[model samples]
Target: MHKPLLVPEFLDRARTHYGDSEAVIATTGERFTYDELGERADRFSAALQERGIEKGDRVAVLDPNTHYHLEAAYGIMQTGAIHTPLNYRLTPDDFAYILSDADVDAIYADYEYAENIEAVRDDVPTETFITNDVDAVEGEWESFDAVLEDAGTEYDRPEMDEDEIITINYTSGTTGDPKGVCRTHRGETIHAYLTVAHQEISDDDVYLWTLPMFHANGWGHIFAVTGIGATHVCTRGIDAAEIFETVREEHVSYMCGAPTVLNMLVDYYIEHEPETTGDAPVRLATAGSAPPEATIRTVEDEFGWYLKHVYGATETGPLITTSDAGRLFEADSDDRFRIKKRQGLAFLGTEIRVVDEDGNDIPRDDETLGEVVVRGNQIMEKYWGKPDATEEAFTDRIEGYYHTGDLATIDEHGMIAIQDRKKDIIISGGENISSIELEDTLFDHPEVSDVAVIPAPSEKWGETPKAFVVPTSGDPDEPGVSEEDLVAFTRDNLAGYKTVHRIEFVAELPTTATGKVQKYELREEEWEDEDQMVGQG
Candidate 1:
């Protein structure tokens, strides 16, 4: 009964119980059964060992959403090495910083991203470079396939302690330098169970790789799906047409993405109608930012898919809450749309509280804003090599809770609604304005495709909300909707104080890889000359 909780157990269970079942369909048209996939993972582990990689060594994976990434994950974990996944969207210099920070010893990179690693080859401490594409391999780099061909399938699983760090996921450095969050084998295992239990993944499920595997370990879906023996349908990148086609061809039952990806799919679906709607009902879990109610309605009504809005950060299991419409609201309730827009109840083993600055719980009135703090088994252990940052993150302010840094509110039904980021909240004339509220209202405008709201400098009121709009039609320089029209529209819908005072039409909003808007970037530009930010005043 004292078995150590390890990540490899998931793959071992799938290989033993579902040996002949199809486990993965790669973007390169490679198919593998559970047995074959397991063997490949073992071979990868053996190959790393042959290259002198040992337990506790850091192994970085730089690849897109492919079967090779999946293999690299399990392979690296099996060898007791810490797996560090790199975001392909990052620059070579960004990769260099992370590789050097994590003290990575070896890297398994996709050929498409090999150039990024090669660009920083001399800067990092990594000694071995393995490329999946053999032809792309040159000068001190090893071919992944060639190594697999020569390596044995019998790799000895390294003895691992459950509480030891298994992975280091770097945050998207939107505000500043990215911080590496260290996650242990125990934490990841607990997160996988929570994901499977809450999402209801099964062997009959076909999961499409819409979310990148680099993001919080694909939101821990990589372990959840594999644990249940589900089929993994890999895609190189997110393309609306390809996603729709794969859903029809593979009968994809479940997938996860940010609202931005859903918006792209909906846009494509409206323009070019696809004929084949699969036999099974499709389930999608979306996060990153609270989606507009219109987006949620479209996903449910037009696409006929079940939409679940999940919420969390890279440090908190990346899945601490979910808003399932059927469970949270009446089937025919008019307020269902509004309720579904909330971040919703905490996960099964998680606890969430919205508290005031004094560490007291805020009223469940859904109006008062407070910091949302969480305590759960799935929370990351610490920020790697940043003891000061880790201590500040888990300070006694909340007492045993991890500060989320998200300002939120709790409704009577106990659902949590994120108002805005603590730093992004606009304080104008002694009143707080939630930018998310204004952005949601603007999303209802037919001419507005995407929008970002930031606190712009205002000498009179300290700061005022500024709307950066991306139009749905016409040239970017001259949008269909004018500034006066948008200002009037918000005034009609929101309070006088919350109404956007300034409007600037732009081509598109800046977003992270996961599609969350980078409001801090806009804020920095607006407050560059100012000594302090809006809230500071």
Candidate 2:
């Protein structure tokens, strides 16, 4: 017998088997058992139904990493309304666009981010507003706690199918207007299962919320960790010292973050050599970009933690592959760091292919670059309300495959390493240069704390590679390394044709809510004066 893979099953199973177990450790120093969390979710379901949120309606939640988000998300999904999460860092106009685009029926914004919603209240179709602290908000809103207390724990759950869209995750509008990526219950369920298998999540593990739950449902750990009956320690935001302290105090065994988070931890380690781990050993899974090998080395050798470098897009499962399988590497091998830096082989039951422009597969020579295409059960159903865009995404360069738009090379072991975004790769004269390669080379320098490489307009070569270096000093004016010396360093390390044409010292790079450097922003600034972008025809 096959049961429909509904998302609510995760919480129901947790409440059944782990009712008395500690489920959530809120940032406000409150703790709740699975039973309590389930009751709260039930209360929310009742409240949403009373507020006229029918099945197939969209419900938006805007909050930092917090238990309220977890409660509200599960509550929304339990009612069969698509749980549409908004990035709290977005602007009021962006919130307006997404809220109006999704036509959300109800919303729960944290006290801090509620004002952004209030500013755009007239622009959205949402009528019922809820906040954790209602008085703290200026607009008409109901208290989450009061709503739950008034809403009796009685509501009918609608029958859900595996193919029903359960969640709508919006992409960061780096390329253009953010697209709502609609995912089915079956896709998310399989993604959670794959995450548990690859990341080795277990009931005894303690998970810290350094990664935002809004970002692909905390990279699907909201379901995976919950389904596994693991303890969740929620945080309002990320900080280096607080993370280490929480790891020791709460015994956080597992967490995931982007490469910027890795850089922050490494920088923190250098400045303050505090104890990095707790009584429980720590494993950090990082994605968003290829982390520098040196950062992986420090995180492993110095911080005494195992690092799992992963890769995927919001259109996919957001975590379709990881690079930390034990069987692939020898015991305590020095070469493992280099191997783990690559986005390793595909996850169980997922298909990853690097295809040329003609839809032909590239060789596994690890040198030829091609666009990464994937066909997986965990891929998104389609872009919400954009049939043409959905058709374009699945039909680009091939049919029936979601084109990742990431240019990469696959090694002999079928592990793929991302070279650059197809739009961001620099075509200097007639040759292609991987900006990731240049950034990785600069990352090895002792003074180069962080770096981002973008294609700057070139008078002769059409476009040339430029480096933005964030020096260890944290001051752009007095960067420890001179631009001339750094230029020589890249020239000595990389191919002669891939030379970095220029270097700019910067205090920090512009990043997205999930800590990915906004290369599109840089590209826009570089090409605003030019007629068109170089890579475009």
The best candidate by lDDT is 2
Per-residue lDDT of candidate 1, residues 1-537 (tens digit): 788888888998999899999999999898999999999999999999988899999999988889999999999999999999988889998999999999999999998889888888999999989998857744567888888899988777778999999999999987667899999999999999999988888899999999989999999988999989999999988898988889888999999988778777876777787742476679999998888998888888888887888999999978999887476678766567788788999998899999998899999998998999999999999998999889888874677789989999999877899998888788999999998999999989987778889898899999999998888763578688789999999999999999999998987777777777777778888789999886752
**Which pairs clash in model 1?**
none
* Tens digit per residue, CA lDDT, model 2, 390-422: 999999999999999999999888999999888
Q: In model 1, where is the ten-residue run with the lowest total lDDT?
A: 271-280
lDDT of each: 0.88, 0.92
